[model samples]
Each structure stands twice: as C-alpha cells, then as structure tokens.
Target: MANFIKIIFFLIIVGGIGIYFLSQSPKIFQGSPQEKVSAPSQTFVSPAPTSYTSPSLSPAPQAISDYLIPSGFSRGQLSPYFEKINISASYAYSHFNPSEIKLSSNLSDNEKVNITGWQIKTNNGEIIIPQAINVYEPSGLFPQQDIVLSGNNYVNIYLSVNPINKNFRLNNCIGYLQNDYVFSPSLPQNCPTPSRSEISYLSGQCQSYILSLWGCKVPDKDSDSFYVSIGGSSEEEVECRAFLDTIDQNGCFRKHRFDSDFLSNEWRLWIREHILDSQHDRVLLFDKQGLLVDEYTY
Candidate 1:
C-alpha cells in the first residue's frame, strides 16, 4: 500500500506540472483547437517619382481633317471670332480688379491687357472667362480650384486650363501635347500626353468664326498658338499658326503650357506633398467664421 500511494503521488505531481506548463504556454501550444494566428498588417509605399506607368496608346484616333486659311486671309477679322459663353459663376470670379478693366492708372503694361472678351471653344461648346489674360489666377482655374484651394494661397491664372484647352476643359483629361513640352520648359518630361485616341483634357481653345470663315480647320502637329496679331496691312487678325478644331480635336493641344507655368512651382510641390501624404486626401478647410483656414491635405 505504501508503494502504491507513492506511485500515485508521483503521478499527481507530474500531471500538475504538466498542467502548469500547458497553462503557461501560448494557446496554440495548448490542446484547445480554437486558437488562430492572424496575418500581419501591411503598409503601402509610394513608388519612385519616375515610376509612372507608360500611358496606353491603343485608342482609335479621332477623325479630324484640316482646311487651311490661305496666307493672305485675315483671321479673327473676317471670322467674327467670338463664341458666346457666360463665365460669371459666383465661385469662378474673385478678386475682380474692375480697375484693370476700367483702365486703372496704376496698371502696368502687362496688367492693362486683361483677356476679357475671349471665348474658349470646346467639344461641349464655348467657355468664356472675362478675366483671363491679366489676373494671376483666371476664373477658368476654378475647375481644378479644389486642387488649388487645397494647397495654394493663390493659384496663377495660367493654371486655368479651360480658358485655353482645345477641349475646353481641365482635370485628368488635361495634359500637354508634344509642343507644350518643347516651348514650356516648365512642363516635365512626363507631362501627361493622351494615351488613347479620344484625348479628353486640353489646355484651351479658339473660335473658328462660324462654319463659313475658316470652314472647319484644325491644328496639326506643326501648329503653334492663337493670337490676334497685327496683319501685314496692320489689321488685328485672330489666328493660330496652325488652325484649331474643337469638334474633331485637330490642332487640339497647346504647344506651350501657359506662359505662367513658372509661377506654380510651389503650388505643384504642395500638390505632390499632399498626394504623398494621402492615405486619402482633402484640400480645403474653413473656420466656423467662414474664412478659409487651410488647404491641400493637412
């Protein structure tokens, strides 16, 4: 009986030690089958700035044919070249210097020419901004104003694409043509070009002066810009070195980005930083008092 009792005690001690060890172990090591290990969470890292994916080029080309304006013919003069549009949206117009238009004595030579009467021709129709050429920021920039308002104190007027784009629009669809990269040194090597046949965004537009004037001409690769330059006879003619087309998108992109592309360097950097910081993004904020407090992603 003594021997049996000693054996039983030994067994009990061994069992208790086993139980304690088991208790101290992780649940997976214990006999319970219910324990599980979860996957580790992951973080995302942005690719290098040069990691831009090659834009696709498989889209069918848009059909456009060009008819030249004879060298002797005057442009906007014979064309009556204003396509009508109303750009007076409350959000669009701000810091209106009526003084600029009223011919303020304080205006500089550059400031004296605010691009008021110009109409931007688009595939959707005409877009007009009464204050284009003079202001630091044109009302046309408002389409992307969310981006501008997000990080900038003030965006330059040249950043406004709608007033200049051949498609009469801005946003993702807007990108530079081959020429814009040439003349506008500010445009990066990767300035977005159309990968598809139906290029959507354009930098700006000009009117064809009713179907009768140029008879539906468009810009080709060699085309340059639109201007109301003094003709050989000294008459102002609305002309582009290459004629532009709104409907078919010929001569459809800007050879040069806005002359003001230099002004937005800080703004561009701010946008990039915001994008980098974005797990998601927000660009604007206001105090309860209704004044803008911060913009761009915080």
Candidate 2:
C-alpha cells in the first residue's frame, strides 16, 4: 500500500514541474506576442489614379480696322461704285482750316463717270458737287458745265468761297490769273515755252530777252529801266515789247488750246463756306440716289 502511495506522489510532482516550464518559456507557434502586437501598428495604402478635362473659351468679335460702316449697312450692301469712286483717306482728319477735301476715281475698266450731283456727307453737313467750265475761255462769258471724271481724274473740293466768283477747269494758261488772284492749292505754272518757229522770227536782241523770261511769267512792264534796256526807241525793241505783252496767260491759252494735254488732270470746286471739322470727323460718300458709296473715319 505505501509503495503505491509513493508512486502516486512522484507522478503528481513531475506534472507540476512540466506546467511551470511551459508558462515561463518564450512562445514559438507563429511569432512572439510582442511581434504579433507591433505588426498592425504601421499601415501602407496605395494612391488612386486621377482623370483630366479641358477648359472652354469664348469666340472673338469681328471688326474692320481702317474704316467705319454705318449702323444700317453692310460693306456688301453698298453701291457698285462703292470703291470705284472714293474719298481721300490720306489725311488724319478732313480738317476745316486750310479746308480742302478730295475725291478720287479709280475705275478699273475705263469708265467715264460724271460726279456733278454726288454728295459728300461729313459729320458737319453735306454738299452737292456743282458744275464748272470744262475748258475755260478767258474772253467769253463764263458758263458752268458738268464736272466729268474720265480716266484717272480727281477733284479738289475747297471749303471757302470761290475766289474768281466761278469755278473753272484749269488749263496751261490758268497760271496767269494766279498773279492777281490767290488760288487755294495754287494753279500749276506749266505754260508752254515760246515755240521754236516763233523764236526764229525774232531779232537777236529780242531773242535774248525772250529766252531770259521765265515760262508763265510776265515781263516787268512797270519798270522803266527794263524798257530802256531793251532800247524802246529801236524797231526791234518795240516788236519785243509787243511780244512780251502777248506772253500773258490769256495769250498762252489762245496759242495752245488745241493741244491734247492743255487740260489738267484735276478739277477745283468751291463749296462757299467752312465744311469739315478740325479734329474728329466721319466722311461718307453717297450716290445721287442716296446709296452708300464709301466711308472714312478719323
């Protein structure tokens, strides 16, 4: 019975020692308790991709940089003569002082256009183009004729009153009147020189005097010294004096009126008062029917 009791006591002691060693030793099933606890402390998460989109913009306005179009009209709605006959855009402003405006014709197909009743409407007011002599005659009654435009012709419109009491076409002889009257945009002084045939008829002293005189220039009739220098007592001197008298503008026109180039390329029209603004202005051209021809702005 004692041996059996001793055997039971030894078995109980061995089981207690095994239980104590297992509780005290480090764990090895998967990992240590500390390692298992620290694994979840740090975390990693990948970022998601993004999509792109484009922006929207508005369209720009349409405009013309050089000239202005009236509110009710489009460029295509204007007359067939729209750009064929046009206002002079060379000035910054079609100003009042020195007060001149110009109209030019640029017909491509060799057309003849009469601009007598055409209107130039400015910011100030409007003016009708009047008639003028086509070929001016110095001796006859002045007759106003329709101002016509042929190949490459231009008209100079003056804002002041007519100086000669009439408008007339300029000829080679027009320069003679310039001596007594002031013409705005002065008349050209391109009178024809004495013909070779005429010069051959004059005496040697008269020839020298004639050659010394300038074209479109009258001799100094008032200078007694000049008359005496030409030897007024002599026959040659008398003839030379007579010839000098004929060197005036009227004489020039009479001699060369039949020449092809006697007429000038420009026509001058006087409007009888100040017409355009000095600083800012808008000029519109209209046909006789009041249709828009062209426009200018400053």
What total of clashing residue pairs does each candidate reach? 21, 0
- What's each prediction's TM-score? 0.16, 0.69
Tens digit per residue, CA lDDT, model 1, 1-298: 9999999999999999999988888854655666666779999898778643222211111211123222232332222111110111111222221100001112222221122333332122232323312112222443331221211122222212222332222221123333332212132232223232333222233233222222223234243333333122321232322232332212222332443342332122100011111132232222222222222222
Report the CA-based lDDT of candidate 2 relative to the real structure: 0.72
> lDDT score, residue 293, model 1?
21
Q: lDDT by residue for model 2 over 1-298, one digit each (tens)? A: 9999999999999999999878866654446555555445767676786744221100111223225456668755565566667785323232333477788887644466778898888877888888988888878666888887866788888777667877877888888877778776566777888976787766876776777766567777777466557755677777777787888877887899899999987888877655577777888888777767777776
TM-score of 2: 0.69
Task: Give candidate 1's error at residue 195 in angstroms.
Answer: 9.1
Candidate 2, run of 10 with poorest lDDT:
53-62
Q: In candidate 2, which residue ranges exceed 4 Å CA deviation? A: 1-72, 75-77, 89-97, 228-233
